[model samples]
Target: MDWLTFAAFALFAVFSGLGAAFLLRRFGGSSGQWLDALDRLERRIREDLVANREEASKAARGLREEVVGTLKDMAVLQKSTLDGFGAQMGRLTNSLEQRLDAFARQIGDLTKANEMRQEALRATVELRLGQLQEDNAAKLEQMRQTVDEKLQGTLEKRLGESFKLVSERLEQVQKGLGEMQSLANGVGDLKKVLTNVKTRGTWGEVQLGNLLEQILTPDQFMANVACREGSSDRVEYVIRLPGRGEGDGEVWLPIDAKFPREDYERLVEAAERADPEAVEASARALEARIKQSAKDIAGKYVHPPRTTDFAILFLPTEGLYAEVLRRPGLMDALQRDYRVNLCGPTTLGALLNSLQMGFRTLAIQQRSSEVWEILGAVKSEFGKYGEVLDKVQKKLVEASNSIEDISVRRRAIDRKLRGVAALPNDGAKAVLELIEPADVEPD
Candidate 1:
C-alpha cells in the first residue's frame, strides 16, 4: 500500500525469482511452473494494494466529516455571544435617555420661580413711586397759597400810601394858585394908575424925593425950587454948592425926573413881535421924547451965577436911561445944545456922593484961616502954662523932702517902742478918747 510495502513486495519478488532460477539450475524445472508462481504472486500484490487503497479512502472520508462537525459547533457558540452583547447595549441607551429627561424638568421649574419673583418686585417699586409723587404735589400747592396771601397784602398797602401822597400834593397846588390870583389883581390896579399922565408925574417925583433923602443931607438940597429968576417953572430938586467968591450966595444944581412910558412900551412891544422896522421907529420916538425933556429941563432950570451951567434929566428906571444912551450921538447933542445930562437912579446917587465930597472940601477951605488963628492963640497960652508947671514941680520937690524927714522920725519912734507891750482894741480906744475926747469920733 505505501512505498515501504511496495518496496518489500518488490524485494521479495526478486528473491523468489532468483531462488527459482537457482532451483532450475540445480534440479532443472519446467518454465511453466515459474510462470504459474509468478502469476499467483502478482495476484496477491493486487489484492493487498486494493485493501490499502480502500482503507486510505475510508480514513480520508472520516477526517473530512470530523472537521465539518467541529466547524458547526464553533459557529453556534459565536451566535450566542453576539446576542448577549446586543441586549446590554439596548439597556445602557434607555437609562441615559431617562436621566436627561429629569434634568430638563428641574431646569423648567427654576425658570418659572425666577420670573414670578421679578414680577412681584416690579409691582412694589411702582406703588411706592406713585405715593411719593402725590405727597410732593400737595406740598407745592400749600406753598403757592401762602406766597399769594403775602403778596396781596403788600400790594394793597403800597397802593394806599401812593394815593395819600398824591392827595396832599394836589392840596398844596390849589393853595399856590389862590396866592397867584391875588398878585395878578394888584398888578392890574397899578397898571390903571400909571395910565394917567399927572399920576405918572407924581410917581416920578416921589421916586426922586426918596433917592434925595437917602443920599443927601436935608440942608444940602431943596425941593420945588424956581431956579430961573424970572420964570414960573419950578424944578423938583436942586443941590447947593459954594459960590466962587466968599460973599457970593450958594449955587444950585437942578435935577428933574422924566418918564416917557408910552414910547418905551412901544419899543418893547416891537421887539417882542420881532419887527425890525417897528423897533427902529419906536426907538427914534423914545429918543425924541428924551431930547424934548432935556430941552425943557435946561430952559426951565439952568441959569448962570445961580445954578450950574448944565442940568441933569433924571430917568426913573435904568432901562429907560440905557435906551436913551444907546441912541447915536444923542447924549453928546443934548449936552452941547440943551446943556442937559442924562442920569438914572444909580447915576444920580453917584453924582450926589461926589457933590457931598466937594461940599466937605469947600467947608475945610472956608475954615482954614480960623484954624490957623486958633493954633497961634494956643501957642501963646502953652508958654504961660509951662511957667506954671515949673513952679508946681519945685513945690512937689520940697514936699517930698519933708515926707522923707517924717518917715525917718517915725522909724526912730518905732525902735524906741519895740520893747513896749501892745494894747487891745478896746483899751487903746479908751486911752485915746480920754486923751482927746473932742478929736476922737464914733465908729
Candidate 2:
C-alpha cells in the first residue's frame, strides 16, 4: 500500500487496539485476543514512521550538502576567472614593452644616421681643398713649359727633360688623389643633400608629387614615383604613359632636374655673345643623357609592371627645353626603339586635365546610381504606405460599426458610471432601457 494509506490503516488499528485493551480490562478475556492483535499493529506503525523519517532526513541532508557544494564550486570558478585575467594582463604588458623597445631602437638608428651625415660633410670640405691644390699645381706646370719653349737649347732641354719625367709621375699621383677626393666629396655632398631633403620640408618635391597625383589616375604606373632602375645607377622621378591602346605597347615618361645649372647660368650671363653651337652641343649631350635615362628606366620602371613600353623623357628645366624638342629625328629614333615621346609643362598640364575629366565622369556615374537607388527606395516605401492605407480602411469600418452599436456603447457607459457610484434601482432600470443587445455575433 501507499505510505499514506498504510499510515491511515495503522492509525485506525492503533486506536482500535487501545479501545480493545480498555474493553479487555473492563470486560472479559474474550476481548484480550483482539487487544494483542492491535498491540502488534501499533508496533508496525511505529516502524513505518521511523523508516520514513530516516529516508526523509537523508534526502534533506543530501539536498543541503548539494547547495553547499555548488557555493564552493562557484567560489573556485571565480578564482580561476581572476587568474586567467591576470595572465592575459601580464601578456598584454609584455607585448606593449616589446613595441616600445622597437620604437627605441628606431630612434637610435636615426641618431646614428645623423652622426654619419656630419662625418660626410667634413670629408667634402677636405675634398674641395684637395681640388684647389691640384689646380694650382697644373697652372704652375703649364707656366714652366711656356718658359722652356721660349728658351729652347742645351740647358733648357736638359732641365725640361729632367722635369718632364718627374712631372708625369707627379701628375699620376695627383690624378689618383683627385679620384679619392672626388669619391669622398661626392659621398659627403650626397649626405648633406639627404639631410636637407629630410629637414627642408620637401616643398619642391611635394609640388611635383601633387602635380603627378593630379596628372595620373592611380592605376597609371609610377607617375608620382621616385626610385632607381638597376641600369640607370641613379634614382629620379619616373612615369609611364599608355601608347595608342593597340599592337601590344605603352609609353614611359621619366622626369627630373636634368638642366646643367653651371653652363646654363653662364649662358644667361652672356646672352648676347652666347655660343649657339656650344648651347647646341650642351643640348645634344642632354638629349643623349635623357635618351640614356629613358632607356634605363624602360628596362625596369617602364616595363609593364613586367613588360616594355614606348617612353617619354621629361626635362623639368626650360633652359634646354627647346633643345630637346628640336633634336632632329629624335621622335623617330624613340619610336624605332619602342620608347617614345618627350613632354614639357604644356603637354603635362593637358594630360592632367584629361585625368580630371575621367574622374569627374566616374563620379557622375556613381551619383546616377545613387539616384536610382533612392528612387527604388521611394517606390518600396510607397508600397508599404499602400498596405497601411488598406489596414486603416478596415479600422475605419470597424470604428463606424462600433459607434453605431448602441448596446456596446451603453455597456461601456454603464461600467464607467458604476465605477463612480452605486446605482439606485429606478435609475439603473432607466439606464438599462437606453439600448438593446445585438441578436448576432461572430462564432
Candidate 3:
C-alpha cells in the first residue's frame, strides 16, 4: 500500500477514536478507558516516528562516509599512477637528451674530419703538381744543355780534322822538291857503301834487324844467332815461331838478307842503255847469284825439326825482288832444290801480320778454356741457389696465407666499427621522435 493511504487511514482512526472518546465522555462522565486508549495510540505513533527518523539519519550518515572513503581511495590511486607515469617520462626525457647530445657530437666530429681531409688532399695535390712542374723544367733544361754540348763538340772535332788535312797537304807540297834531292844523295851514298863487301853485309844485317824490330817484340827475334850444331853458321835474324799445337816446342825460322844491289844496278844500267847482249848477261848473272844465295841459306839454316823445313831469303829492295821473280823458273827451282822461300819488304810485312793474327787467335782460345771452367763452377752454384730460392718462395707463400687470414678478420672488425658508428645517429633520431615537447613539462 501507498504511504499516503496508510497515513490517511491512521489519521481517520485517531479522529474516530477522539470523537468516540468525547461522545463517551459526554454520555457517560465516568468512562476513562477510551481516553487512555487514545493517549496510548498517540504515544505509539510518536515513538514509531522517532525511531524511523533516527534509523534514516544513521543510514544516510553511513552512505555519506562510504562515498567519501571511495573518493579518497580513487584520488590516491590516480595520484600514484600519475607519479609513476611522470617518473618514467622524466627518465625517457633524460635518456633521449643524452642520445641526442651524443648524436650531435658524432655529426660534428664527422664534419670536422671531412673538412680536415679535404684540406690535406688539396695541399697534397698542389705539392705533387708543383714537384712535377719542377721536374719537367729540370729535364727540359738538362736536355737543352746536353744537345748544345754535343753539337758544339761535333763541330769542333770536324773543324779540327779538316784543318789538319789541309795543313798536311800544303806541307807535303812544299817539301816535295827537297825530299827528292835528299833521296838522290842518299842513293849515291848507299851505292858507295855497297862497293865494300864487308860494309854491304853489315848494311844488310842492320836493315834485316830493323824490319824484325818493327814486326815482332824483342823476345820473338834474335840477331846474329848461330844455327848450325857443329859449325858457327850465324844467321842475321831468327824468329821463334809458335808450335803448331799445344805442348809442342817452339821452332826457329832462320832469315838471311842478301842485297846484291850491284848486280841489280848493272842489270838496270844495261837495260836503260838498250844493249841487248849486256842486258842478257847482267840478267843471267843476277839470276845465278840469287839462286846460289838461296842454296847457301837452305844448306846452312833449313834444318828440319829444329828449324823450319824452309828458310827465308830476304831481298831488302822491291826492285831487286821483282827482277829475281822475273827470271824464268828461278823461284820454282829455289823452292824445289834449295828449300828456300823468297820475300821482299811488302811480302814479309803481310806474313808478319798473319802471324800476329795467329797469336791473337791462340790467346783467345786459352781465354775461352778459362771461361769454360768458370762457367762450370757458376752452374754448380746456380743449382744450389735455385733450391734455396724455391725454399724461400714456399716460405713467402705461407706468409701470404697468414696475411690473408688477418685481412679477413680486419674486414669483419671494420664492419662492426661502422655499425657502431651508425648506432648513435639512427637510435638517437628514433628516441627523439618518440618524445613530445609538451611531455617534458613538470607536473
Give all TM-scores, in the order shown: 0.55, 0.32, 0.46
Q: Considering TM-score, which of the candidate structures 1 and 3 is the better prediction for this target?
A: 1
Q: How would you encode candidate 2's per-residue C-alpha lDDT over 88-167 as one tens digit per residue?
A: 99999999999889989988998899889878987987898789789878987888887677667767777888799789
Local distance difference test, candidate 1: 0.84
lDDT of 3 by residue, 1-443 (tens): 54544665586578667767676766576556666666666777667656765676687689779999999999999999999999999999999999999999999999999999999999999999999999999999999999989988988998898889888887887688678778888888777789887778888788878877887778887887777788698888888887887888878889999988779999999989999999889999999899889988987888878788998999888999998999899999999999888999899878877877776787788699898999999999999999999999999999999999999999999988885645485587696776666778787
Give me the displacement of residue 438 in model 3, in angstroms.
63
Ranking by TM-score: 1, 3, 2
Candidate lDDT (C-alpha), each: 0.84, 0.64, 0.85
- Could you tell which candidate, 1 or 2, scores higher by TM-score? 1
The model with the greatest TM-score is 1
Over 184-246, each residue of candidate 1 has an lDDT whose tens digit, in order, gives 776776677578777777788899999989888899999999987777899998988878998
* Selected candidate, larger lDDT, 1 vs 2: 1
Ten residues in a row with the worst lDDT in model 2?
197-206
Off by over 4 Å in 2: 1-207, 213-257, 262-271, 305-308, 335-338, 360-375, 382-443
